[model samples]
Target: MPDECQPLHNINVGVLGHVDSGKTSLVAALSTKLSTAALDKHPQSKERGITLDLGFSSFTVPMPARLIAALPCRELQFTLVDCPGHASLIRTIIGGAQIIDMMLLVIDVTKGIQAQTAECLVVGEIATQHMVVVINKVDLLPAELRHKLVVKACKRLAQTFAATTFAGCPMVAVSAKPGGGDGPAPPAEGVPELIGELVKMVPAQPRLVRGPFLFSADHCFLVKGQGTVLTGTVLSGSAEVGGMVELPELRVVKKVKSMQVFRQPVSACRQGDRAGICVTQLDASTLERTLLCTPGSVPTFTSAIAAVEKVRFFSGTLPSKGRVHVSLGHCTLMAEVTYFGTPDGSGHEPAAALRLVLDRIGQLALNENVGEFDYSTDYAYQHELHGLEGRPSASGRQCQHYGPQWALLKFSQPVTAPKDALVIGSRFDTDVSKAACRLAFYGRLVALLRAEDPSELAHLRIFKLKMRAGSIDRVAPDGFSAVCKGMFKKDTDISLFAGMKVTTASGAVGTIEGSFGKSGKFKVAFPKGIVPAAPGHNSITLTFKRYIYDQNKRNMVQ
Candidate 1:
């Protein structure tokens, strides 16, 4: 398709890195048109000499053949979202990341990946699928050793991210501002090359244009007489002039008075497109960082179930029932987490069950097939999410797939979350001056518990594995009943174990009928024609599970 024959497609690219990494200058070098709030337009940002909020800018080009073949667009627009790199401003960076389709991880060549840079990298790994490593300030290196050092640095960074989603991603060396913006070098040395690389990486998948419209308003401001212009990306579905939308968080609903794509007035907007939505009867100041959507299309949840993975560089261990700040789209809220997963992945289940199933779920998670958790399946509780496994377990395990696969998050406050939104958990309480990663883990919200419907907890069934062993003392003449000893302590309440299932090592399965003689001995009743291989010679094992968060204490056997 030719450039003028089809509609324009927009791709949001977030420029993220540590403070003083030249991210704003890099965006300036790539953007042809700067939005009103772009490039440190904030007074405080200019005074502080660092990006304090997300800056928006863009440039256009002929749509690549890959995308043209996949959609009907003729022109491709690259919208650069310049995210603040300061550690304290991570919430802003996280919010910016959710609105992007790709990431440009800026690294100052003179200084390799710094503390905040690593945090941004983790955000990239969690929030987006595509990335490009921008090694900025290459001019700072000694001219004689620059080329060799760039190649060596690229190789080292590649190895560092080999186990991450960023493995083998494109690395572009650029001098966004040569001579540190003072010398007589060209404005940018390697920007066009970086753009070319990005062109080839545009996602070929079609954008969502049919669901209920959801718009994320990153920057909202009044326009003389027109209305409040919400400048952000269309997250899903489509919207047009005069369409009815709701600000669910504020309990306000309004109609779309008008819309624009980069100052070009348009009738509508679709998913993956960046635009300004004009709405009347609202104060922009009261609605900073808000979301507008078709009525009731987005849900506000007080708790959610999310699939989790450990941040490879996070030094702190995540404990069950621990509190962490969770970032979802435009907001960050504190949440208490409960961790659990299928028995096969973490080797936390009993050895008997582990031997029955040698699972490759970690391989699945590594390959990104670990979404849509199965609530019906059995799970084992963890005291805490352990670090990466150093060596294979006795079960001949695969490489370490750090962290559990699922977590139940009880938020401290209600949040509006769309389905499958990316969730990032961080310990922002950590000292900012430290070199450690405060991001504990990242994942997607697989399920939600609405604030109005507290009964939704029944759908999340994470449980704990329990096992007990005892010896069969004797069998009845009919070979159907046996007396089990040593199953519990002398003063134990054996009634709680009644009707639970147990199996003999010799292949006989039975149930604990009741306690016998008050010595913690129990009577096992096997089915007709079933018996232990030998009376007084066989051992019995009982296996069952108790749902981790259930208050009723119901026992279940598999």
Candidate 2:
């Protein structure tokens, strides 16, 4: 127990692991208190013998010396968010991971890291920097070999996470249910040791409690005649009794009647603190989950632009125009991604319609610390994913690659989220039986498209390069001109491509001045006289680009 007068600071810890890896049992062993939706309370979860939803529970410990020196709290609350490990429920895991301060990656000691463990590892790396890998169910091993095998499992896990952000993180062996599985288990082993390790690492990962009030309400229900209660973590800022909250989904405004932390009444809640907010007159059934914040703090968006980075574990390519399941806030909605890149070279000038859209993207380039899509600069359509070194040129049509990239996520339905919310794109359509990592990329929303102007970028432009090669048939009687064949069909309209630039394979630069004859052959003019090539001998190449979505049906060449 802690001093009633002393303040309590919170650290939301997520317990993530594979199915039947003892995650719920581990959480049950560690938790001193449970919230409304804690444990496997769902009827379906009990019937299936697995966790089917995001469960919330917590325990409190005396504040450590390091934290005492930094804050004014006397007790530290470790809120346990139990995330399901089933492959089909990965969307819930991804959505739940957004609110956690740190992650506890649980691994079954006997089986080691399984496929689901690997996927959870990817989410942990992308979710937060702090992680403590828990090796559970050591009690299942024979006593004679338990010590040896446990040590071996720890070493194996440490090696597997060596290159990840959690490298050198603490690894503890624990038996949540010493009697095994469920039913009236004996006292848990090594949990106290696990708690000590968590306390040590938390001081380095501080919470931000300042800013405008923003609460991520994950579970909402009516509390008899009192009112409706919204339970979740405070994403940012603080709100107190009587403070007004806007429910964007319901389009209603309500005043906070009271607040509580793990059933203890509190005057207010701040960022990083998990609390239940009670408000009057709002129907619980109206919203299953939503954001409760200062009026209009978040908006509904039909689409958005994000500065994206590829997740390394995702084995597949993130091609432009690919369909992905996008996780925005707590909503996992289907989306179509349009990826583009900014290379280092002379930027292509966009048409008038495109210039306006880029101007809008420029306004959204916020924070300044991280690069967003540059609307002032032109970008090219990326056929495949690019790394820090960029990508190779195609068809030798000349290209300059840059490291930074952006993605345009167009959702099938409208969504509500604060600006700069974390964006995770996944390919849930992938065959789960293959055990492949379906997470394609992750980024932050930089530009938001309002519902009314969904077609604001209908004419957006990204260019795909094109190249054509033809043979220098012969030098006309004049040495300054040469007839080039193979650039077009015999019946082609030769006048349409007049004056486009072409380069010879021998390093000579020239231009198509006009048509050579009715056979669709063309004459290349080299202002500086060129060495005459034997009939049908030398090679020449033509390079150009065409906008992918230009409504004018325009093409460009240089």
The local distance difference test score of each candidate is: 0.80, 0.78
> Which stretch of 10 consecutive residues in model 2 shows the poorest summed lDDT?
355-364
lDDT of residue 235 for candidate 2: 84
Per-residue CA lDDT of candidate 1, range 1-558, in tens? Answer: 433412788889999999999999899889998887899999999888889888999999987766768866768889999999999999999898778888999999888989999889878866676899999999999999999999999988887666566667899999999887544657788998999989988878777788788888889999988888888888889988888989888878899999888888888888888889888989888878888888988888788877776675798889999999999888998989888766755444332211111124232132143345555666667777655565333344466554356778899988887766778888999999999999887777777775235355655566778888998888888988989898789887788888988888877789889898988898999985466465556888998777755656654555
Candidate 1 — which residues are off by over 4 angstroms?
A: 1-6, 65-71, 181-186, 344-375, 386-404, 450-456, 469-496, 501-510, 525-541, 549-551, 554-558
Cα deviation of 502, candidate 1, in Å: 4.2
Model 2 lDDT tens row, 437-480: 88877777877764235255634456767788898888767678
* Estimated TM-score for each candidate: 0.85, 0.87
Candidate No. with top lDDT: 1
The residue pairs found clashing in candidate 2 are: none
